[model samples]
Target: MNKSLLKLTFTFVALLFGLNTFAQDDFQGKAYYMSKTTMDMDQWGGREMSPDQKKRIEERMKSFLEKEYILTFNKSESIYKEDEKLEAPGSGRGWGGFASSFTGGPKYKNVKDQELLQDQEFFGKQFLIKDALKPLEWKMGTETKQIGQYTCFKATATKVVDEFDWRSMRRRQPPPKKKDSSETGDSAKADSDDPMNEIEVPKTIEVVAWYTPQIPINQGPDDYWGLPGLILEVNADRTTILCTKIVMNPEEKEDIDKPKKGDEVTQAEYNDIVTKKMTEMREMYSGRGRRN
Candidate 1:
């Protein structure tokens, strides 16, 4: 063979082998997430609920207070779903009513397309939430930390959300208390510790996330993303979702397909729907209290 022709042939063979090897090196990923929720029980406490009642409420909701999830992803696509939960049915009581109010369903994100798909259930009806990814501005920090074996960088961003958001069944503001002429002085005024006064609708939330460049993916649990790497820990709105473990290129690559069930709606539209529904329920319960 001619010397130049032989060199070209060898180069072509090496290129083909490199491409094959890259194709076989799976980037399929799996990440485990655990979320903890803490609510301001001030409204339910005070004169409305006694110490015994507060204890009951907390004990009953021990299971719903925390959640676990698993995120399956690749380089450009990902799906986040809840892990197996052992929660029993909630009763028709104080925060317990919130149990049936919000359940974080499967969320699918296509980083390549900048789209989002989330499955939600409210009062037994399914809703498929489809919307564009919320644009985030993360300030990268010079700090680095180790989460497991991966070195992670710090990122922070501000997230503004509806004050009455029930997505997480969080502390939604209720109807303002009416001033009574008979009650005078500071005793009548709402206390500063009252969360209802401090935390109102249209609240600003700060997001702190730690992501690992080793993962090289803009993916995280729930609605969090737009980071330089896969987020291993996220804290926002007093809730935290931390990565318990990660398995890259898992043998069983679970489906990353988008959920195709339920009534379709956008993020804003769904928020409005939940606000209206929660208001109605609140009114119904208040009327019952008045009658009692």
Candidate 2:
């Protein structure tokens, strides 16, 4: 072959080999992330619950959350999927009392936690930002860590609220109820009560995510993503999901396919469910407290 032809032939061979290597590389395409969580009862406002109660609550929470997630990425597309399951608010005396009052005055009593658990189901979805691949401002952080043999980087995010998130809601600020003249003295004392003022100061939450570049897959336990590597530690909302095991590029290449067309709920909708339930719960507790 002539010099130029030989050069072209060499280049073509190199390209073919590079493409083959890329296709077979364990860390190149898609990955799966899973974790087991042991949320602290006190951390989640279940401080009043006994250890056994907390254990039951945790089991229910974990079972509801137990899911398989798939992440897919290539030069052209990216996608995600959560194995679907039915979920409902877990039940206990506290949750039951709250639900009973809010749904109307005691249509039910001593409801089994299992029966209550069937009322709802919530999960995350595939997020397709127009340019999800073109990197944005995200740092896996400076903290060095190891999840299994893979060394990881840390990342953090923060949120702050000066007032209750629902303070601006019209329904939240109800017109003062008219007090009967016969109960004026007691009503006057009740009117002076302020429950909002009793809330403990919101504590600052810092999340430290451990990502391993070895994995080369930007994925995490939930909606968290866009890190330089697979996230091994996820701390948010006072709850943490740590990766106890991470196996990269196993002998058998597992296919990770993204959910197609209508498999999961939007993040906004999920937020609404949680907000509504929490509001209902608060209202239930509020009505049970005797006016001072």
Task: Identify the candidate with maximal TM-score.
Answer: 1
Q: With candidate 2 superimposed using the best TM-score fit, by how many Å does residue 160's alpha carbon deviate from the native?
A: 7.3
Alpha-carbon shift of residue 250 in model 1 (angstroms): 1.1
Compute each candidate's TM-score over C-alphas. 0.74, 0.44
lDDT of 1 by residue, 1-292 (tens): 9865664454456445534433543568899988887766774453588889887777766566677889999878899987865445563244544654565478899998999998878787889989999877999775777888876778899888654554333434555766755655443332332333434444577889998766667888888898757899998876888999988677777778988999999978988998798667656655555456
lDDT of 1: 0.73
Per-candidate Cα lDDT values, in order, are 0.73, 0.44
State the lDDT of candidate 2 residue by residue for 1-292, as single tens digits: 7865664454456445535544643443444545333434574457788889877877655543334444443322234444344456553344433332222110101111111000123223222111112222454345565566656666676534223222111112334676655556545444434344234434333456766655544445444556655666676554456665443345565453332333234334545556686566555555565532
| Model 2: CA > 4 A from native | 1-32, 36-62, 65-140, 159-204, 244-292
Prediction-by-prediction clash tally: 2, 3
> Each model's RMSD to truth, in Å?
9.7, 14.0
Q: Model 1 has how many clashing residue pairs?
A: 2
Off by over 4 Å in 1: 1-26, 40-43, 46-56, 87-97, 164-202, 282-292
